[model samples]
Target: MAANGINSVALPPKDGFASGPLSPGEPAAPGLPLRSPNPLTSKVTSVLSTSYADAEFRDALGLLDERGLANSAETRRQLRLDIQKEVIQSNGDIITEFGRVADQLRRIGTTIDKLNRSYQEMKSHVTAAHKATSSTLDEASNLIAQRQDIEKKQHVLKALREHFVLSEDEEASLTLTSEPVDDRFFAILAKAKKIRTDCEVLLGFEHQTLGLEIMERTSKHLNQAFQKLYRWTQKEFKTLNLENPQINSSVRRALRVLAERPSLFQNCLDFFAEAREQILSDAFYLALTGTSPSGQEDRSVKPIELVAHDTLRYVGDMLAWIHSATVSEREALEILFVSDGNEIAKGIQAGRENDLWRLVTDEADGTPEFDAVKALNELVDRDVSGAARVLRQRVEQVIQTNEDTILAYKLANLLNFYRVTFSKLLGTQSVLLESMSNLETEALRQFRSLMRDHIATLQGEFQHTPSDLGPPDFLQESLKQLTSIMKTYETSLASTGDREADFQPVLAESFDPFISGCENMAKTIKPPSVSVFLINCLLVAKAALAPFDFTQKRVEALQSRVDEHAEKLVASQYAYLRTESGLDTLYDALAPLQATEEDIAKLRTSDALKPDVLIAASQNLDDFLPSALMDAMENLRHLQDSKLTRDITEEATEKFCVDFEHVEEMLISADEAIEQGQTNGHAGSQDGPQSLRALFPRTTGEIRVLLS
Candidate 1:
């Protein structure tokens, strides 16, 4: 730098002044100062040290003094002046660039001012354009809303047509003359009904012409469908083969729907029941006559009347045939009635509710309050009514003509058996059951009449009962017949609603008369044998009645009678003991005494009861005591039961012993009276001497041992 700028170090001897600064390490010229005048001045590296802001200053700074030492103050002052000149030159160039930028900024401001005025000119034209299109846009919007509303109304109209109108194919299924009545027919019929109902809702609107038209059309279709169902049901019923005991669901549903028209439904039922009745009546005639209703001989099955030659068998065969037919008929009809009985009830109930159903009903017909079970039972009863009538006639003839009371009861039991059977199959209110019941009552009446006439013959005749105190042969024979009748009744299937009440008349007619005859005969027997005879009769009656539940009270009554006669036997035996054992005289003496017997000491004052008489009676008792019980029992030996005889004997012996004790007490009182007289110095009061221990020597304990 010193070579390029001012050199403070002199060049070698260039006239004693530096033409150039020193190169490299050259010494300074003599007398030249090498020290900087301001030490900080040489320490300065550059005036434009951050030359990156202006790259032009970098070259200019290097051209200035790289002076290392100061020679004089004038030389340092020239270096300061050079640095100040460079700074002033650089500031002038920056000011010159600012002046060019200020010109360009003014030109841009002028351009922005002109564009702002042009935008103001376009604003009014755009607002005028918007104003011109507003009315057209409002009209277009109104047109779009109207178009959407019309499309919505079209959709609503399509839905209404589908809901209120039936297709031709669907209508044909219900109303077409050639269409068969079936499940599909019924389904379309039901749809027509629902549309008719929905039309009612449509009728609520102000303009109801559509509702009225659709309802009229649907009602016509419903009527046609129901008419088809009715004719189909009637046709099916005419050909119904009830042998299988089943009805199809289609036919069952048809019946349920047709029931809404009461006159039509009732007419169909009347025909079915009538056909069944005629068919069964013919079958019964064939069963009876061995010939068909058309007069052909039926060789396949034997005629019931021919096989059953006897009266009871003929009647039983008729009833059995009726029962079998009733079962088959009931089994076939239950599918229509009992199995779906509630459906019949509901159908009638619904018919009563429907105004449309009311229009078809005949006012004179009693069809509104129909009972399904009653209707079924009546129908079945009618079907077998012919057979039931024949059965009643045959059974009544047999029962009424039957002279044998036993056979009459057997017929009664047979009638009751069939009566119960028909009641179970048909019900208690059944006509067949009522006829059988009347027949049963007639048979029982015949039984009772025969029994009464037979009993009357025995009572009116003077036939002697056997001499042996026993039930007569007539009673035994009647009882045997009664037993046979009872066994037949026991096995019979008669209703046991109140068996005791029902059979009590039979007992009274057949049994009570014989018992009364026995009592009459017992009255003619000898007095001692009367109780034994009655006891024997009642015991026999009781044994016969013991095995049956219905005869429990009768058995109890017989037992009570037997016991009553047994009490009489016991009393007779006790009386015999009192007489035979000499205790009767002592009891006679003691009979008049007070209950406490305060006057017993004075009993010896009576001559009949004196001490010697008491000794005589006591002596007689001593003789009787050895075999007292034996003698008492021997008196009642004719009693049928040995146990009863023994029991009567013991009771009598105890009574005898009790009387002996009383006599001994009386004798002791007499002895004490004599002693009191003798101690008071009057010895005459001791009547003829006999001690109490000596007289009446037997004690009650001894008597009990002997009796046992």
Candidate 2:
């Protein structure tokens, strides 16, 4: 032992051990057996063993603390000893626990080895099982994927069947059977049409046979359905009660559906028209004569013939009935034909008018169809044709038998009214419209004939013209008739074209002939009075006609005629004034002398133009001047218009003043020539006054004043 109290030291064995890393839960160093050899090696061993005792000494030294210092030596030593014993005992228990831990670790190692072996064994089984079932699992996955795809395909097929195929009952309702064309029928037809339309999508696919087959089947069904509707509609039309002009919904549906088939629709319209024609014909007879085709319809409403015994009223009532009937018929037809557009089959013949898509594509895969408005017009014309014929005969009969031109004119207006009404309701080329137009034309012809006959009678009766310069009685009566006729034209419904042009013929037939008759009657009136008579007649015509627009040209023409005759009257009045003033003879004598200066020189000494002759003419002028205006006015006193009398008097006076001025100039020239003659001593001394101023003392100024 060392002097410090370490007894022994532990060292490595003489066999020599290697130093390396330790395992888990290992001590810092392992125990080694010790053996003494040389003193040097023994010293290394002693030093090693002494290190263990040094640690114990260090702990024992710590036990000599503050408390330990106060303690007795024995107690302190005993405490150190207890501390060492406890340390040793605790280290022993630790060693014991470590040893038990080592045993458990060894057992755990064995179990782990068993577990790893079991794992090695089961891994091969798992691999083998996986290998065995891999294809089966893959097959199951593929089966699931295939099942999902099959479900999807099944869904698509179900949808396709619903889309492209009509059910059996729906098919039967549309084509196979004779059922009333109702909403159900229209519904089924609409479905069939949709199926056909959706087939276009089918056709877009590579397989188009399905689409083709569906389209073919649908087209056939549509044709058959339309044919049934057409025939049903036509048969229904045989008993169509147009008396109540409201259309039946079923009939309307049938017509709307049938319109999808244009040819069949047209045929149906023709059939309906034929049926209505007969029905309306009988209805017309009932209204006209209070007798049906069987002669047993209600006679409560008296015959139109009885109510309209007057010829104008008779034609008017008939035309009224026709117009009303045409309106009602058109309304019903519009209801039947022009409903809202079909969803599948548009009413387009080949294309919708204003459809922008129509430029790029033909939306209508259907056949050509007649326009609804056109077909409606055709039907209306045919339906009314029979009644129109009856009305025509009656109207022509009245126009022919009735001698009253005014009544005939009224009948013509009535026909024109209905004609225009029919044209609007049907069309301009409707047979009924054309017939009415013809009847109107005939009525006008009859009116003109009656007018001519009356004129002829008047011409035969009044062989001599009126003594007074006034409008003749026949002329006045003709003007009154013309005025009434013009009123009819003013209120007329049908304007052929330009207002002035259309009425030109009327003027030619009526007003022009009146003018001609007046001219013929005025022929017997001698000279001056003829102008006054024409003026009076023309003035009356202008006043009567100026108010109407269509007669504006006639009024203007009358004004021209009036002006013409007025000019003639003024001329005659001027001539009367000239003769009264004795300027007529002077003018005649001056006419030849005006050609040359030598003739002018001769005028002073000429017998016809001598100073004495000119003085005598002046004396006559002086006398005429006092009463010239009165005498001039007296010449036209027979003029019916006092205003016109004043106009003519003033015009005549102006003319006289002009002529007087001319006479004065020539007289002054003659006077100057006379003075020249006197200076040259050709005529020696002039007798009386030499200058015409002194000779014809009455100047043009004085004449104008007197006329004024």
Candidate 3:
């Protein structure tokens, strides 16, 4: 029945009596007591024995048995059943009590929860009330503070009106005063200063600080008013007459007032800036439309001149005013003046490039025209590099248009003018020099091209004619052209006064092809023809360049080029003269005569000598008969003192001598054979001796072999 699953009672002793009586014949156990006997006692005892695990119930049963509750069997049975029913009833009572206690606890928990939620709600309402009360108090405090501040200001205003009084003179002078124009101005200014000091002292400490601040604000306002008047006066002053000296004094007074204010002095710069802007706009318009100040289109006034004149006038007037006003403003005035001048310069440069370029190219010398260019030069700070660039472009254009030597000469003359005219800048700037250089380069390029073409024509003509000799007409004409071209180039250079200019490099380029052509022609044509062609080229080059002092190196180079080919031709000619027929047939022709004396004698009669032997014998002399060979030999003969020519000539002569010796040996054999016949058979051995030397006809010339 308790929470621990047991009754709240002590256990019975092991010897205690059962809850029932003993049977009639059954005795109680030893040391255990039992007296009562009832019919229900038996059942009670049986229940107690069965439920003995409930020790407390068993103990209570023992007490009841000892108290005579069970005496008979019927009574015991009755008691046993009665006790069993009581036990079940007691258990039911305990379970009912536990359910009642749990219900009570749950209801108490619900009541506590409701009380907690109600307390939270009341706290929230109290907080809102407190916030409203605090807000109301803050508003009341703010209202009180504002009322106090209003009262204080009123009191201060009342005090100021009562005590802050000035004299009539002071009151009148306290207002903003214009600077005086006459001798009384200093007296007025002194009165104004006294009025300001007296009012400042009249106000108390707090009011004095406040009054000082107010006065500062008033002073700034008055300063602004004065500056406004000064600007207006300055604007009007531009058209003011100098004849009215009083107006001049007034203007001077205003300027002095403005100058005294260091803070407001910078405002005058704004006026100057406005003037500069107007000047720039006007200048730009004038540059475009060539319009005068009166709005008429005036071509007589050039844009540059207009810009310069306007700028100078503006600067001069502004500076004169500034200097007349105060010396202290010079530094500031000059800065603005120069800045305005720079703006005007930039505006003048706004002229169209074509227009400017036309001015550069114009040859007219009218006063307006000359002044315009000069003014433009001054407007651009006297730097004409920009115009120089235009001139350079013009030179390039001229070069592009012309190609002939005559045209090139004309272009050179034009460039010469540009050079001399612009020579002042030539050393300082490369534009002119570069322009001249480009002209020279272009002229030389044209010359080289012409020379190449002419050389090509000469080469073509040579190919068509198929001759081993010159002077070809095409070569002659080309040489003449080349000479003319060189002369033209020299003249151009000379006119330009470029004393050190060398045209040889261009000539080298032109002559290089000619040299190569001659070399190639020499390979196929006779050396004499090639020699003659090269000689003409060399002579023409020399003659054309002879007059120029700078052309000596070029002339030497040309000679060297010609000489290179000339040497090769001479060696070739030597080889040509040394060409000998094959001696095989010649040897065979003399073989029979070598075999016997009679064989040699037979040949004298029989024309059995092979024609190759005569041809071979005549080979040395035949090599000299061709014009090319003749030329080669002549050249070699002239140069024989030189080692190379001497060696070549000596070698050629040696070859000729060897060839002749072979023929002479054959002749000696034939003569010996004829003498043998004269001794042996006494025949006609002299049809004048009948020798091989006699076999060679007289017209062929007697061949002598000089043994070396």
Per TM-score, the best of the predicted structures is 2
lDDT of each: 0.74, 0.74, 0.49
* Order of models, best lDDT first: 1, 2, 3
lDDT head-to-head 1 vs 3, winner = 1
TM-score for each predicted model, relative to the true structure: 0.69, 0.70, 0.31
Model 3 C-alpha lDDT per residue in residues 128-166, reported as the tens digit of each score = 999879978899999999999999999998865544433
Which ten-residue region of model 1 has the weakest summed lDDT? 2-11
- Which regions in candidate 2 have their CA more than 4 angstroms from the true location? 1-168, 175-256, 260-263, 275-310, 342-372, 493-497, 591-600, 609-619, 665-696
lDDT of 2: 0.74
Model 1 ranges off by over 4 Å: 1-178, 205-218, 283-291, 295-324, 338-344, 353-379, 417-427, 461-463, 488-497, 594-598, 610-631, 679-688, 692-708
Task: For model 1, state the Cα shift of residue 686 in Å.
Answer: 11
Query: Candidate 2 lDDT, tens digit per residue, 114-175?
Result: 99999999999999999999999999999999999999999999998887787787778877
Model 1 pairs in collision: none
RMSD of each candidate relative to the true structure: 10.7, 9.4, 23.8
